[model samples]
Target: MADLKGKSRATTTPADGCALCSLPLLVPQEPSSDIEDDEDEETPSHLIDDVELPCGDHFHWDCLMNASKISPVDKLRFCLFCRQQAVTIADDGSEKLLVHVRNEGGLTSNFDLGEEIRSEIAFDSNPHLRRTEAFLSLMSQDDLETAEEMLRGEDGAEPVDPNSTYEEGGLTALHVAAYNNNVRAIELLLRYGAQKDKRSNDGASPLDCASQVEAWNAVQVLNS
Candidate 1:
């Protein structure tokens, strides 16, 4: 089993295919540069070695960084593959997180713009409500990593109640997942103690939310 708090203890080998991009992990080579004295030239992505996520999945370094660019550093501190919380252990026995700056071509670029309008809005007065917003946002984007962290409270943060309702939509995480047609998220929420029959402020169950949105996959998961 992999450790959720820090780097995974699971032994890993350089696999043939990268878990993130599904591309071959070729042997690393020295980056060629015609301008030898140029200080501004960045190292090429292909020159980096394979990187192992805390979940025990191997990915090309560029693929991992590319994936990192999609997630907000403040919200997603876990592995995108297995939703395992990852941390770097300092010499002083404290854990620190190193976040990569966001760039284009990640989840933000592929996500539907209209979906943001429908996402759960956070109330500015309460910081706790941001957790709810984060959960809903993760569900909307199918971001299992941060969602699992919130659900499990693995990092010592307060666990996100699966039945907790957002002030704006008055919807639970399940409802949000259903509305997004996120079957995997629906399953994860259900496994983490979400009640499928729990009603929103408008008397909408998760199934009802899926039905309203024609989220067939979510409906099937909820029904099952």
Candidate 2:
């Protein structure tokens, strides 16, 4: 009976899959003869451990490590499949995640661009707003080249105002760049006429936002 109960419990646990490779969760298998001579065939390390994404999916630790190597190191880590929050066990066993909340307008909820600024911009037909949103998204993704094109109106789109504030947070492109400590983005926005001292609805300047986020390089650049 005890053996049967143990088997039942083991069977009840959902099988985990590697979110990156879409393979069944597995430990590194012994190399077979066909690949044994291939020097490039490296063993995956997550055979003995795994991490859980925020959406409750599991992936091999080695898969995430490999993915990280080809992606921007500073960008937020997300699930390879779901594009949602992902987490790994810390050496100290604590969990860390970045959570962004959105409001009805599909913009970040916590910050506002102030009623005055919001009223001045025509939200309905503003191509600039759309471009700015795209630019900000690309910036968040660390897609610097595409973001630069968007900023420069290189795709025959209307030029975006680098200083334009988001209706939700009163955040300029500079604010976003500064918060992310993206020095290149900051320089680009400045070149495009982004104001250094423009404050959000919360009265926080981009530098202030950088300070709060501990973006030291942003703080230094904004100060200069």
Candidate 3:
């Protein structure tokens, strides 16, 4: 995945004005020499990504993502819809605000975020996904001891429903254990007869699911 590191794009600071809404941006005639390259590096919150807009304004990748949740895709891109810029404002403010170009605005979301940031990746067939959900609920309601006790109950009985799928969304108990990131839970699930090589609807092996999920810790525990 591409990384944004010494990636330099002369960060321009617009003139002082209302940054939160579409207020006229006032840029100083000349930029000071002492400005750092990444002056835009700081944000009030974590920014997901930078997206280029038809309005010639760039919005945070997630700002567009959240906007997508509310607006239709056709409204996402103004140029495509033959409308004026969907939203616009100043990009040089302390914060880049998404404002109405007043016509259409579409949002683009790069879903590869988690995989991009992770040092490792894995896939695990998550059969019995509800089992994982149930475990989480139980874990939240009871102490770790109690959660483990329930898992270990029925004398090494782990769930046998392969339909509890994950990944391709088909998961077994062993897959759930690895998804839970619990080393002992994995061991208990395996001891209770959860198959190691079970394939999911997407033909993902348990190891495959572990890799994609990046449960490296669980991967090591289960493989060993």
Candidate 4:
């Protein structure tokens, strides 16, 4: 008998198309704790219904989590799926992320200025609310286009939250861009009228955030 994980919501899911991963396991894998004494595996935060990134590989929520467990190291790293850099182990289970920038066909040089502005204006309000740190890290890496795209909302006009807090301070998108030391992006935000002197909730300016990140170049851009 297949050990169904908890109570699956799908009663009549197809046999061949197993939802995400069409491949069926020879049998449903049981919880890891069933094989070993894992106290941490008691309450599974992820469930089958809760799976994100909708892959073809359908495993138990706990099973998927175990398979995706990329342990932390105190240095730079990348996630296999997203091919983006991993910043840190956030208090939440998700890893802080950066944008994946590849220099294929030299798209960076060919980017259209008009298109950039259009893209900025296409942002939707109420965009993804989490992953501020990862977004900031991506911006810092000079993947400005991808960073802006991620920051955009479904409508793609303005960020979901204009005044949304990115970090502890008043470091919003504008602040993170400036701290990232991208002069072009810094200038773009400033020209677009992003507030420079705006303080974080902690009263720290974007300049302060840049300083902490050791983004000396951004300091120069801001000062200029």
Q: Which candidate gets the maximum lDDT versus the true structure?
A: 1
What TM value does model 4 have?
0.36
- After superposition, candidate 3 runs with Cα above 4 Å error: 1-10, 14-20, 23-51, 60-63, 77-185, 188-197, 201-224
Q: Which tens-of-lDDT digit does each residue in 99-207 have in candidate 4?
A: 2111111112111222222222333222353344445566567776665664463334445333346545557766877666667778756654567788888788878
RMSD of each: 18.1, 16.3, 14.1, 19.4
What local lDDT does model 1 show for residue 136? 73
| Candidate 4 Cα outliers beyond 4 Å, as residue runs | 1-59, 62-141, 147-163, 167-170, 211-216
Model 3 per-residue lDDT tens digits across residues 1-224: 13334223324433432222333332223434686557766422212233434444543433444444455544643522234554333446321223322111122222232232121222122434445555554543434454455466542547333223433466655565666566766665566566778876667666676777899988897678
Residues 1-224 of candidate 2 have per-residue lDDT tens digits of 00011111111222756667777654555655675565677654433233444566655545654554455433335566777655444579654442222211221221211221232233334756667777777767878788778768898987666777776878887888889898988987887788999999889999998999999999998888
Residue-pair clash count for candidate 2: 4
Which candidate do you rate higher for TM-score, 2 or 3?
2
Q: How many pairs of residues collide in each model?
A: 0, 4, 42, 17
lDDT of each: 0.62, 0.61, 0.46, 0.46
Q: Which structure is stronger by TM-score: 3 or 4?
A: 4
Compute the lDDT for candidate 3.
Answer: 0.46
Can you write out model 1's per-residue Cα lDDT over 26-82, one digit (the tens) per residue? 534465667574568755444223555444555555665455445554333566677
Q: Estimate each model's TM-score.
A: 0.43, 0.43, 0.32, 0.36
Q: lDDT order of candidates, best first?
A: 1, 2, 4, 3
